[model samples]
Target chain A: MLKQYSFEKTAVQTFPDNVSLAMRTENLQVFYGANHAMHDADLGFPKNQITALIGASGSGKSTYLRSLNRMNDNIATVTGKIWYHGVDINEPNVNIYEIRRHIGMVFQRPNPFAKSIRENIVYALKANGIKGKAELEERVETSLKGAALWDEVKDSLDKSALALSGGQQQRLCIARSIAMEPDVLLLDEPCSALDPISTVKVEETLLELQKKYSIIIVTHNMQQAARVSSQCAFFHLGHVMEYTPTATMFSNPQIPVTQDYISGSFG
Target chain B: MEQTNFQLKKQDAQSHEWDARLHRATRATRKDWIGRGISYLCIGVIILVVASMLWFITSKGIATFTQNHVSLWKFLSGTNWAPDQGNIGALPMIVGSFAVTFAAAIVATPFAVGTAIFMTEISPNKGRKVLQPVIELLVGIPSVVYGFIGLAVVVPFMRHLVGGSGFGIISATFVLFVMVLPTITTMTVDSLRAVPRHYKEASLALGATRWQTVSRVILRSATPGILTAVIFGMARAFGEALAVQMVIGNAAIMPKNLISPASTLTSQLTTGIGDTIDGTLPNNALWSLALILLLMSLFFNALVRFIAKRGQLKNGR
Candidate 1:
């Protein structure tokens, strides 16, 4: 039997006035047709830090993450303010294509184009009107190194990406996204499909990436959140139930729903 | 008492049920046999029919060379085609077939790809609701109707533009273009739609514009399928007879220019078959033309299969 918990009593942490945020959402309500998926999810992500969104399936963690860069523009109706660089990017008139350039995204599945690894990394670069051969080669080397895939795939940069293992393909996807040099990177369960060894490698890569890019990840693994993220947000039934330091959320959850979820009593 | 009785029943059931044996044939089994028999019979009949047709055509086609003494090289390279005067050079019809087929495919490719892209990537709902039926209707329309329209409208238009009888290669090409456009466009749309949705999402998430995503990602990935569609369209154009015949004027002569009258392999076969006597050289030569058409279609099918296999390999499927 699942116990009913009160939705009104919640604990949401807020940052200090001096803390610079990479992005934030205010009164963010998402609707798929008439189904309200997310409601008033006001949260701030600190700059240059990893923030993990943890929840059960269909809890709107992915919906909220996708909306951070307006990836849900045509798929759903979002009525809220997504502030990035002090501009409300949720506005309809805003250029989403430009917004995506600054805030790249990685999907749960590694969708490497059916091209060579070099071509995969440089395709978006070429599309953005960069044509210098030496520059493209440089970016390819750096981005692949950044994603920690260069050492393994350096010899076969011309090889088809589909030839890579699941973990390698996921890293290549990360490399593809980061090749654009985005400010903030959003990952939607990026490591869920990976094995333990690959997961560790990806986690290590994420830790290394934190020094350069702000990271926001949605993960189902609580241990992963505690291991990687500095701050953690736990979502339940599309509501932001708890937001606190990763250690505190796992060690001492301030709410009943979060406590049960962490204990694996229910999700 | 009831428990003991149930245990005894279980023991009895287990002893016999656990033994390996087939059940008695029921009415359903009879019906199953009948259904299987019917399907196998249909397949057997079709295979026999096709094999016999191949045998008939090949035997009759080869009689021209073995019995009538026409050189294969001369027949292929000969510029003149007159069976009555013992000049059975079929180069004009061969060239005419290729010209109309190539011309139609070249003109139809851009329009087909554009329409396919519009249907798949741009306004897909409009494409499904409005354009899909229109394309299907075009496919359903009989070739005779299309040929009649060409004879009535396109021929006169060609006459006004080029100042000839308007029955020539150009007119036949226009007719074949209309006939093959739907075949190519529909297949192209299917191919474009077959591209995985994730490729588009990945491209868009990289901040690529819609046009950039479509041209660089979607169209590139669909290249094999699109090429197959073009080849299939060319095959259709190459084999179309009534439509080309209505506009080609059936001259059976060398096509001096695009505006001059000529005949395709199919056109000559259709019109000349009725004029020649049975077991004669003229009839056997016509059979040879049919053989060429058959070989060309088989080549097209082989090409499609090869591309599909290559595409599968590239995708690592």
Candidate 2:
């Protein structure tokens, strides 16, 4: 119904050898029972940086993000090589649970476990066999501080996480993932359900987190991509259309679809 | 003033039309009233029947203690229940009823939880296609058929295994366990399905295995609902009469062992009601048993409501 863009002329870039990559995909494609939801999405996330995947509704950015930790295991058929920490983690025999421990995910909705704030952070830690009281308490504090939530929630660690405000819940989710001390954090529109103030707070937390964890965030908000990301990848109709520096993609988009989308003329 | 009067005249005409429309008995409105009136009449009839039954049972049950001069504590605490020979103690039947119901619930709960987990979390599509109708058919089965099967198969099996009359507490418990299994399983499946999808997703994304996720988060969130299901199954088991009567030997004595013949409130009431005179103590004692059954059902319902309210409070909503 709208003007269609050619997928053949995508402006994806290849970083030089000196730029260290935390994770990379080689021709990653996704299929939901023959629907081919994502196609040939080969992208790289740099170490200790935030890369935002921006796109419209039905774009494959979220699909691609979910494939990194194999979260789409039963939901869709993803085919390609997902290289993480010098291993092809996409293989079926690879322990996805272990993969996820090193590379964590945060969902669009703020889905904190129906637990207390301390328990929400310590649940996965305990499951991973961290059973000491002092270590658990320390990880809870440090992860909460890492997500910038410690100052507000320090006094009430026993309170139910659901009792927190929406912003605080989202931040707690970030802390829960960071508590695992993941090398890469994949967020699928983590702030889309949040209010403006919450969104700004999440953005600030993300910027602060980039120094430790490699973050790949899929968002529908263009300004969020510009503000929080150093690298930007624009997706359209299951294709990766443009990948560039965040400033360059905002100022001079390499393709018509990316330009029209960010300028709000996308029909 | 003239302009306002002209506007007022127009408004008066509009109001007259509005009044006519308001009073008009449109066909749709008449149809609505007829439907509502029929439903209300049905509910009224049910309410009247239930209220009258309650009144009749209460009066007749109270007659045993008041008109026949039996003390409340003796009726509740005494064990000998020879109603004809004036030894009417209802404690044996009370204990029998509770024993069978609790035994059945405890045996069936683990099986129900396992099946419900399979239906909801493990293989949902296959469970829906295969197990759904199977459970529905189980619910639709007549209690008499279940009783018959218990009499033929389970009774003989118990006789061979334990070397007794085959009709005892264990046989009735086996029958009731089968009967209440489907009820608990279906309700448990519903509650498990009601758990939010995001809880499972969040747990899995945090690198927890499926077992850990289901046990820690999904099952934790659904605990109240699953408890309600178990309680509902227990209520059904407690109230089921004819099936339990057929398998449980109607001997009104204190049960000493699992294999011994015992009498529940329902079994004793059914066995003795037809043979007793209207004003006699035996008939009145049967009525008293019915009252206890009614009160126990009400207690179970209250317990379910309490659990649900507590669950909501814990969820912080």
Highest-DockQ candidate? 2
Native-interface RMSD of candidate 1: 1.4
| Model 1 per-residue lDDT tens digits across residues A1-267 | 557777798899988979999999999999999899998999999999999999999989999999999899779999989999999999999999999999999999889999999999999999998899999999999999999999999999999999999999999999998999999999999999999999999999999999999999999998899999999999988899999999999999999899999999883
Candidate 1 structure lDDT: 0.93
Q: Among all windows of ten consecutive residues in candidate 1 chain A, which has the lowest summed lDDT?
A: A1-10
lDDT of each: 0.93, 0.93
Top-TM-score structure, candidate number: 2
DockQ of each: 0.67, 0.84
For candidate 2, the docking band is high
Task: TM-score each candidate.
Answer: 0.94, 0.97
Candidate 2: tens digits of C-alpha lDDT, residues A184-238? 9999999999999999999999999999999999998888999999999999999
DockQ score, prediction 1: 0.67
Per-residue lDDT tens digits for candidate 1, residues B28-75, read 899999999999999999999999999998898888899998999988
